[model samples]
Target: MKIVITGAGGQLGKELLQLFKEEGYMVFPYTKQQLDITNRAKIKEMIEKIQPDYLINTAAFTQVDLCESDIDKAYLINGIGPYYLACEAKEKKVKFFHISTDYVFDGEKIEPYMEDDSPNPKTIYGKSKQLGEALVLDAYESSTIIRTSWLYGHEGKNFVNTIKKLARHSLEMRVVHDQYGCPTYTKDLGIALKDLLTKPHGIYHVTNSGSCSWFEFATEIVTFLKSQTVVIPVSTEEYGLKTPRPMYSVLSQKKLNSNGVSLRNWKEGLHEYLKKEDDENGH
Candidate 1:
């Protein structure tokens, strides 16, 4: 089967590419320079040329604060981009897999969000992703929209790498303790995505099994690295960001569980990710 992955240079996309290559599948990985998803003509042309059985879209304007400031760019990349991809995929009779986020919820609910829960996005980024989800589902009945949270990987600028970088240079690092979500390892998620391709198509939530605050995640990183940096916990107010984050963005894997696919616990996934990084760097 021929599979096309957008955002090929991204962490998740790179992981997916590796997994697909290992499986001996014919994969076409396209970076932003190769194919602009926001350009409908380019998207249509790529879909026509690739003739893929699956088009997994990982492209997006992901900076939450930047999205808040540049609403047009956010919508263009996250919303209209996916819409065009879905449209092209529909026309080509290919299965569409669009990655979404847990930020679609307003964080008012304390429990892990189910797939059927109503989305009340509180930021421009969340709203744009929500819009993208709607477009994907509406445009293609065969599409699978996977909503994940707190994604980090070895290849990209994510929370884990940021913490690791800071730990190497800083004596003390203050992390927000109040904001809570699952820390999804991109490689694990990449494996999950490959598994999901064999399952029935629909909306699924794929994240590490458990949830934790940023502070807890940071503490684990410091502890694992045996770094001298002290990870101090602080509230979101103390950390003060331009974008309002979801206080609780834990996503339930009930849907994936029903499909007979499950992810390991967050801590276990984290350990594997860190170990992989260490191994790669000859630590």
Candidate 2:
């Protein structure tokens, strides 16, 4: 099996690239510098040449705050980029998979969001990603769109690493207790993605089981690392993020479950991630 992964430098993309390669699959990875998805000509040329069996796009404008200021760049990269890839994949009959976020839905629902739930994005980042999901599916009906939330991995900047860094110095840190979402480890998500290859193709909510608020997530990190830092809980208003985030974007795993796939709980995934970090650092 041959797979092409975009945004290879990203946390999830890097995890997937390594996972696939280690599993004995022929994997081709491209960073933004190597293959800018915004360039349609490049996408077409590459797809035509490789004719890969699967093209997974993890490239996205993920900085929520920056997306508000750089609207054009956000839309171009998050929206049109996936569309261009979908079009090229369609032409070459390549199976397409695009990574998306929980931000697509507003925090209106108190319960977990289903895959079929309508998206009512509240931020520029969410809106742009929503557009990407729509465009990819519209261009190619057989494409898969995996929606995840609160993703963290060893390879990139994420909440887990940030908390670890701050805990090393800060005695206490404030985290929002109101906003809720599933904390997914990129390594676990990558394993699930590989499982999805033989399953049906469509929008699926893939994340570690269970959910928690930012404060709880941070607390978990500190506890796992045996840090003395205190994770103070605060409301979203007190946190004062420049860009608003979904207050409750926990995604349902029903679809993934029905498809015969399920990930481990968030805490378990986090423990493994921290252990991996320790091993890498020679701790």
Instruction: Name model 2 segments beyond 4 Å from true.
Output: none
Per-prediction RMSD in angstroms?
Answer: 0.9, 0.7
Q: Rate the local accuracy (lDDT) of all candidates.
A: 0.93, 0.94
lDDT string, candidate 1, 1-283, tens digits: 9999999988898889988999989999999999889989998888888899999999989999999889999999999999999999999899899999999999988999999999999999999999999988888878999999999987799999999999899999999999899999998898899999888888899998999999999999989999999999988998997789999999999889888899999999999899989999998
For residue 128, give model 1's deviation from the true position in Å. 0.4
Off by over 4 Å in 1: none
Instruction: Name every residue pair that clashes in candidate 2.
Output: none
The alpha-carbon lDDT assigned to residue 78 of candidate 2 equals: 98
Worst 10 residues of 1 by lDDT: 135-144
For 35-90, candidate 2 gives per-residue lDDT tens digits of 99999999999988887999999999899999999999999999999999999999
| TM-score: model 1 vs. ground truth | 0.98
* Candidate 1 Cα lDDT to native: 0.93
How does residue 57 of candidate 1 score in lDDT? 97
